[model samples]
Target: MSIQRVVAVVQDGAEPFGLGAICEVWAEPYHPDDDNPVFDFTVCTEHPGVVTGRAGFDLVVEHGLEAMADADLVCISPKHDFDHHAPAVVEAVREAHERGAWIFAHCSSSFLLGQAGLLDGRRCTTHWRYAEQLQRAFPKALVDPDVLYVEDDRIVTGAGSAAGIDAALHLLRRHFGAKVAATAARRIVVPPHRDGGQAQFVRAPVREHEAETLAPLLAWISGHLDESLTVERLARRAHMSPRTFARRFRDETGTTPLQWITNQRVALAEELLENSDLGVEQIAQRAGFGNGATLRHHFTRVRGIAPLAYRRRFTCIESA
Candidate 1:
């Protein structure tokens, strides 16, 4: 089923990145490129306004838990004190689930689901560090520590940090399709797919040296997405061996040269589609896809819709 309304429920001491991942996935920008809908996204808390973040910053939320009443999807974002139960938040999720909203949890947020009695007899997962505790707390929960995420009975739970992105994309794929999901992934510069069962591994943080060294090259590449961006050519441009450049590229951007270029091109094509009157072939040329067919091929593969269809979505001029 297609979901258009999304409500993320947050509590005090929310984990910043965990909440950010939920917003990143559900707070979508309209790209009819895939016949995608603009989501009506809201972030609600039990007590609205000045919600404290685990990272020391505070969020000024405007809505309360009642905002979840009509949501098509409800996400429980992780908090620093996830094990601590808030009765209002728990009951809110319980009601949402009973009313047939798609329920999701990120990291220790799964514990909230357990408190709501939603995880009972449901296969779910959480961060590896908390898996055992979660299983013990909710004995009826079939918690799988080995998986990145788990979805059962309209409920989804993901491991800590960035794994939330994987679980969100999985939900997007379920509502839309692989192409639409892939397009969203590209927009965020994440790998298009990661299986739910993939082992959670340590991700190295980018060192300052890597970003500093590659800053100029990355800027240049962004500007030249319309040009041939082969790794060897880029390596030469960076004055490094192809092998060293490839490794450095990954280290800096978390993606390879080719993938980065392709993502940039797709982004450019999307922009042109939204704001330009250029024909498909012209848009393709400008975006470095070379021609309409190539643009269509990639657009269809990534966005699940053709260029013309994408353009038509934005063609109607709205009166102010």
Candidate 2:
């Protein structure tokens, strides 16, 4: 199979890290002599040659708009200001979208794509600081202000500079398998993926009365996950009926008690997998999975990998 073609647009007053991120993902040769190449990337400018960056330096690009003709993917990094978008740059962005290219924009670059009407009716994101401006400019676009990135089909937008790496890795995971994406992540020293969306980092929700009462019960349940943690056992610990405990758990955590415990167990299992030299069965027992087979099933469901394989990939214990 042939490599995918990607054209990254460069402009005056561009953020160095933002632009470098796009280039790194699409152009930098990480794996040499690979049978299948990742991407054939070209840096293009509205004017071929010198373009000033946000840090007050000029970068030279030999390719121009013609580079987009063969591009399967087009990435636009943050330029100066939305109001200063060059006509040629906007038109090229529009034309590339019209020709069925998967478009990606990092940081404020989404503003230019929004200006070109490419983000109309599409869910997208930009840097959190400028998210309000982008929303105000393009009311038709669904602007997710809290996300690190939003994947709206062929149009992908990332927030901030480092978040671009996350977005790019997500794109890699979409195109390639999880293993390939994981390999790419190791090469770049970034997280393989972040689950549960960006909502986890926003302001915490206020807990209700019953949930507040479950604190001690929650601590006890966490400590004894190895034992059979049935609803009856938890209810007895909390001095409540099983039905009431279940209802209260759901209301307080916005999820069932069982689900919350499962998440905690999976997280503990991941920590052991990464830090301890324990066998899968040992880790499974400590994390309340009972056995390796049970652990494998739940680990795959939550972490997208088998227990041993995950350990082999992420284990990093330092012997003192």
Candidate 3:
């Protein structure tokens, strides 16, 4: 096998937490006696000197952007500031991509790539707080705020903090197969592959109600997503008029009843598609999408892939 050379570009005010996460997976000798290092990683920066990290630790870099010329992969860890991206840093990323190097950026480093114009016309994600800024700064790049990461062509970006691990594992899987990725994850004590689209920790809109509002009914609705559900039917179950139930449902759940049901149904469909032998029709029924066509439409809309294709690419039944 050919050696894999990777360069991690660091800068001032860089989040060492993200840098450490990248090193733990890619830089360290994960498989000590397996013959060779999985990656030949070099910590690089614009200036070849002692670079201070956000946490006050000194990171001494020996290589500059010139390192990217010979690198198979170029990685960038997140920095704290979103507004003041260095032009030199952006040019290095652009040059690396132009030379056909696989570009990986965790968290806010994606903003750097966006600044460099490499992420234009590509779907990308970053820390949710910076989502608006990323979109405003690079209108050509499609900014997805909810996903853990997005892989558009050779450019891969992971969302904030721990989500970087997910993106790194995905890169591992793409290069070395699920087995190698799993081995690396076991060494690091993390899941080998997390479906990258898992939501960033979002507070559930529904709150507990004092009276019999819609909690039990909502739970029941989740269980029977394939069942024909309507506002009037749900209201009857809650023993309230349709109009009163609609208003109360909004108050209790913090979302309209239909929207809440659709979200749950989609989540259920995703689980079935990932874990079970069920066909599209069966998954749709179980997840309350009505039919295979409906499931396909919503699945493609939300996940950007067909159900079978997603299963083929991501299902780890053998590994699990």
Candidate 4:
């Protein structure tokens, strides 16, 4: 179903960043000629009164939990006390889900969905810090702590602050098409999609020395993405045996050489699609994918949309 109305549920101690992330994606108005869908966005709390945020600030919310009853999308922002959400708010979420309205939970707000019993037997995720707690609290919910977001049926759960944007964009892409989502992402000056999962954000042992050694080679590879790059070629450039380079590259970059190259090539293709008038075949060759079919194979795998479709949505042009 097309999303026309979005209601974000806020409460005492709401995280400002999480709320802002949802508002930025759904509430912001862009150019009328861009064909972007305009949503009727509302912010409501369980009680229509002054609500304090975690940052020691206050907001006077005018809408109540009932505002979410007919919303096409209902969003829940993080709160300080995940365990003790208002019964009214939980009921609002459950009702929205029952009626087939899309429900989104950002960060600790997933706990509210858990309380509402909406997450039972569903795939969900939240901030890695709270992943274990959420899983322990709701054992029946399939919680994937490694992804930036998880979408099961119509319910979406974002990992943390910025992942909210990703989840919102994902929904937009599903409802309005890639072009509309890309326009929204461009207006916000954020990438339409991100590479990898939230696992990339998790803390890992530092490889400071190895990173320092590979820094120059990494930069060189980025500049020469159009060239054929293999582990053997990179190892020769780094003055190391292929076996040693392969192991060290994984330790330093947390990904294999081929995977890193593919990501960089896809990124380059995205920039070309947004800012240039190049066709898919030319862009594919320029980004080292060899051909349009090859480019489409990797681009669709990484960005969830074809290169041509992404360009159609994001390319800036003058009207006659």
Model 2 agreement with the true structure over 142-212: per-residue lDDT tens digits:
99887778877578898887888888876665555345555666777886664323421333356566445
Candidate 3, residues 93-136, lDDT tens digits: the string is 88878878888889988888888888788999998888998999
TM-score of 3: 0.65
Ranking by lDDT: 4, 1, 3, 2
What's the true lDDT of residue 284 in model 4? 90
Score candidate 1 by lDDT.
Answer: 0.82
Using TM-score as the yardstick, the better of models 1 and 4 is 4
The residue-by-residue lDDT of candidate 1 on 1-320, one tens digit each, is 45888999998998999989998988977876655557999999988879999887999999999999999999999999989968998999999989889999999999999999998889999999999999999999999997778888789999989899999997886566555777888888997766676656523464567544787887888788778878889999899999988887766555667766776687677667766677777778888888888888887766556766656654542211
Which residue pairs in model 4 clash with each other? none
Ranking by TM-score: 4, 3, 2, 1
Least well predicted 10-residue stretch by lDDT in candidate 4: 195-204
* 10 residues in a row with least lDDT, candidate 1: 311-320
TM-score of 1: 0.64
Number of the top TM-score candidate = 4
Question: Please, what is the TM-score per model?
Answer: 0.64, 0.64, 0.65, 0.74
How far out, in Å, is residue 224 in model 4? 6.0
Candidate 1: count of backbone clashes, pairs at least 3 residues apart or interchain? 0
lDDT of each: 0.82, 0.76, 0.78, 0.83
- lDDT, candidate 4, 106-207, per-residue tens: 988999999999889999999889999999999999998877788887998998878789888878866765566777888878877654343436334565
